[model samples]
Target chain A: MFEIFSYSFMPRAFLVGNLVAVALGMVLGVYPVYLAIIVSVLAAIGVEKLRVDYKDYAELSLAVILSSALGLMTVLVSLSRSNSSIFSYLFGSISLVTPEDLWVIFPISIFIVGGVLVFYYGFFYLSFNEEEAHMAGIPVKLLNNFFMVMVAITISFSMRIVGGLLVASMLILLVATALRIAKSFRDTIIYSIILGIFSVNSGLFISFYVDLASGGTIILSNIIIFILVVLYQFLRDKIRTKRFHYLTSFRR
Target chain B: MNPAIEICNLSFGYQKNLLLQEVNLTINKGDFVAFIGPNGSGKSTLLKLILNTLKPKKGEIKLLGVPNFRFTDWTKVRYISQKVREFNDSFPATVKELIASNMYHQMGFLKLVTPKLSKRIDQSLEMVGLSKCRNEQIGNLSGGQQQRVFIARTLVKEPEIILLDEPLVGIDQKTQHEIQQILIKLNQKLGTTIVMISHNLESIKGQSNKIFLFKDMDVFNYTAKEFTVHLSKKGEWVVNNSYV
Candidate 1:
């Protein structure tokens, strides 16, 4: 791991991933998930409200567009060096993660995270009940748009480290999975953070040992934990039912 | 005096089937008016039209002394729709998170207003009398409790006019009465003008001061006694020609 960090790229990946996650966790936590929920739910009144549109399709288009753009941009600036070195930007070869990548990643992450933290509650409210949110004078449209754009930024930037093939797994594997075992949104968030940290560290080392990819290993770990949680809940329920029967029989 | 809410020649329909027609009404502010109609007779649609969620093919509505559908007037009006039936309970949000969100949206995102924001959250929670359960997740809450959360959400915003579409449908009698009394008090004490639609018209009498019946986008007004004559009075949800 120390040798991995010496390569400059690993540290850059860490900085980008952590910063982007924090920003997304704060902003999307409020906007698209909450406020958009209200709009999307009511939009259910009209068909195709939640239906994925050309814009969503456009994100898929980004991978191809971005790969070419990276290839072109890399050549334009390589002035001194040129070769398969471009593979660093194209695929996250840990060895290729440069200090330059950190410069690109840091400011974007902070801006996204800082913006979300400042307006946390506003985003929180628009999400609660949009009709009421609007009546209460909440700027529903702005916050709704803010969330979509923020999520867009997070997905776009983070796609570099985790790759598009695996980026969605980050949220679904950790946050969405932990939610099954938790009650409140706040609690679910806490649980996801705890679960995320544990899953990532363990997965990282195991992947190193198994000679597998780090990101995919973390996602697999999360899936296993998710199964365990469900099993625990099911067993606990079963035991409670048995206890209830025993008490009823004694009373009879 | 012009009523707080007035509709002239109100009518609404989908592509072809007309929901209501030839409707006219005048309402006073602070009046606890109950809207009674057969299922699909356009009760919810009429209320939605009042809130501008649905547009009438013909007719004009005035609310809170402003044209009902005008862009700005909506801020003064609040609505508690028939249970939204759309919240993904699995969606992460605490009861407090859900309730406080109403006021937060009002302040607008991208601006910071602290303490005052929390105070507003508390006040909204207090309004619906759910201040204690503020920290609970909305998904974990009971249906009746969730309804109270919605009430708190509406209360927090402090709108001048409120429209509820069938608030007392499937909840227990106690929850129904609690909701009814709360709305009645809001109208009488705060002078908030109220228009409510109900599948259970009978339960609303003690709380209602006026009544409107929906028939094919048309509206007819009456006192409680007359409201019953035209309606089933039994308050059953599927109102099919049960008028007594």
Candidate 2:
């Protein structure tokens, strides 16, 4: 790893890594994952604040955040002049994850899971009706901020394994598929967790044998599951409707 | 006896123009009050201020003898906003789930709903005549049914005081009547103090004991008969700035 300093392009990473280590509590020196969590959480707070300020034009705030983030990434990528590094960040390289990353990831995972469990009803209530939740003593603003922070932490940590571009698939696609089959909120949560774990494990298994990109393979697995679920729901609903009509006509 | 709600010299406005000016008011316990006002008459704003959702530019509000800002017992004071109309109908929760959500403070964190709590939820649903639709998706209900579901959601708390902002809007007359009956029952039987903002004065005429007419950045207290006579005359009185 030290021999890379001889390369012309290595100085940028070395200089910035040292600078970030000095500025962000020396976490960048031992583990860069902490820096990502801090940056993502700051961005989450910024986005959430903008959302509150421009509540009437919420999509506009999201657009601004998205474009600014992409622009910054482009600028950083150009400055570093490293195509491989950008590719790893975009599609994820499992080999790049260090054991030190696990130390940070494990506790954050528990925090996210525990936070969700504790505030489950609050989240559900706030999603349905915010003012009513507030009046009912739900601490709407605090819970919302906590939830955003939790999501930010999850996305940042997940990016190390799932890549930046495909992280949303890890978060949303499984839940979307589960929603189609779930009868209740509890069912949705259970199904999504099962789908998420299954997709990721199977994606890793297939990638090892086929020599495929782990993140892309995982997202592809999710897509396949989602498509199959969609087809299943469509066929089931069609059959139910047909049977209902057949029975009604026969009785008539 | 302390007033259920007390406002003393409260002034509120939006930058340079005052909507409510040094308003002092009181609602005795168990009194069914109606806030009858015109569009942009600051009725909803007054409700928001009373609920402490909006910071008053000046003055104080007391609920059940406790100062508004220091009051932490919010489960005892329920508020149903006009925002119920803007609720996402596609939200995936059943009527029972929605109603049970209000009892979260009672349920404690990370704990499952108990059988007793579930029974209370069923009772609230039954009160709103939605026990049959307990498992139905709240979003799939009719506007009237959704309103009643929200009422059940509020009722589940068994609140001491319920502040409503146009609870009867956009629903059928029958549903509005049903909601009115529920409010009346809550007030008469349980002695729950009711403060509601309504555009339909006729519906609240016999229901509400006292009516507060919001006009010209001031609040005036009136009996039902005085309000009707005043409405007939249409602001032709040359009276003093007396609140009552």
Candidate 3:
């Protein structure tokens, strides 16, 4: 684990790490996030054409693509005969990131962030109600495909920093934490991004000094933040209820 | 004076089974029309066809004097499906924020909500009596209040024609009455055209100026007064006298 962070002294490593965290944080939800990524990867790899050609059972598209991805990964792993590379792909190794990775991540980040900002309202509406968004002339299919493409691009690149196994958690957990305290959608997104940056940076710093896996450290940091937020919400609600009872009792 | 919505020999089917056939109807401007029929009568299907969500297998639909396919001015129409309740409640958005989302298309891409748009949101909320709950999370609202919030969301768009599919289904009586009153105001005061689908004919009898009854694959049109007489003759007088 420590060997993986030996390159932590390089500022580019932290920059790439934090960028991955932010991209993951921006797409916050469990099922939708996974669906977007899966659909996007499938579309990118021509699986969607199969669905279109064989319209008889289009619902099986997701299952077909998911299994195909898993099978391909297994085959690739066996053919490469390099367990160390597989380990880095599964759990992430910051030391493994090259300047080439930075170049790839930079342009992808700009595209994802720019697209999200431009269609923020459409995305928000679609999330709430698909039918209503469609009726409002929001081009539901186009927006959905665009979202899936963004998720695919983000996941494909960010997996280098967060690992394929933990990328979804990084996307969801901080937003869940933000939802516990943030009252509005904008606030929730802003808080989640801030929390994501903090967790990634801090986890990187900790893993560098403490010799822990960077991806695992980052996930642990996010979980700790989530637990603290949940506890705080619970205690705050309890105190408010107790105060309400006391005030009413005194009045009576 | 062009009709608000015109359907000519419209027919739609799923697979090989026809759901609606040879449906021809004209809804005049500012007409409060209620589509009353049994389940599977294609009332909702007709609304979807008018909204261009569902394509008719044959015939044509003209919306506000333009062919349905050529009707690019969607801002003039607002549709509230019965599935509005299916919205993700856990989504972190205030009632005000959700309502403001209706302005996105009109505001175009990448534009911030201006003060004028915010004022419109306030007015829409005020109309639906959800002004006090503007900052409240939508999930925290009651089912009826949530429906009202959706209605406010539609109202914020300021559409010329509002179509609702069972807007009062599963709502409390008080909230139902409140929603009806808001619709009545929109129709009577603002002269906005309203097309609603409801199973309970009595509730809409007094509010709607015209009624379209669906039976088999045909539709029968009638004025509100004529529908009352027709229902009485058919020995099916289930008028909700409380509201009447």
Name the best candidate (by TM-score). 3
On residues B76-173, what C-alpha lDDT tens digit does candidate 3 reach at each position? 88888888887656778899888877888666557357788889999988888888999999888998999999889988778899999998989888
Q: Write the per-residue lDDT of candidate 2 for residues B1-244, one digit (tens) a residue.
A: 6599999999999788999998999999999999976789899999889888899999999999998999888878888878776866555677777777777877766735778999998998888788899888776788888888888888877889989988888888888888899889889988999999987766667899888888888898887656553232444422233221
- lDDT tens digits, residue span A148-179, model 2: 67766776666667776677667778877887
| Window of ten residues with lowest summed lDDT in model 1 chain B | B235-244
Candidate 2 colliding pairs: none
- Quantify all predictions' global Cα lDDT against the true fold: 0.62, 0.75, 0.74
Error of 2 at B169 (Å): 1.2
The digit string of per-residue lDDT tens for model 1 on B1-244 reads: 5478888887667879777776788888778888876677777777777877778898898886677667475546788777553566666677766765555545544444457777887876777778888777777777777887787777766778888877776789998888887887788888888888876655766778787766645666777654443333465443334342
DockQ of each two-chain model: 0.41, 0.34, 0.49
**Order by DockQ, highest first:** 3, 1, 2
Query: How do the candidates score on chain B by TM-score?
Result: 0.86, 0.90, 0.90
Give per-residue CA lDDT, model 1, range A1-252, as digits (tens): 011112222222322332233333333443212232233223221211221233344333333333443453444434324334323223332333457656756887787777777667666555444555455565666666565455445544544445434555675667656767776555665798799779868877887788876667777888899889889889999999999999999987
Q: What is the lDDT of residue B225 in candidate 3?
A: 80
CA-based DockQ, model 1: 0.41
Q: CA shift at A160, candidate 1, in angstroms?
A: 4.6
What TM-score does the predicted chain A of each candidate obtain versus native chain A? 0.59, 0.84, 0.77
- List ranges where model 2 is wrong by over 4 Å: A1-31, A53-86, A93-105, A130-137, A209-211, A240-252, B7-25, B53-62, B66-72, B107-116, B215-244
Please state the interface RMSD for every predicted structure, separated by commas: 6.6, 7.3, 5.5
In model 3, state the lDDT of residue A4.
13
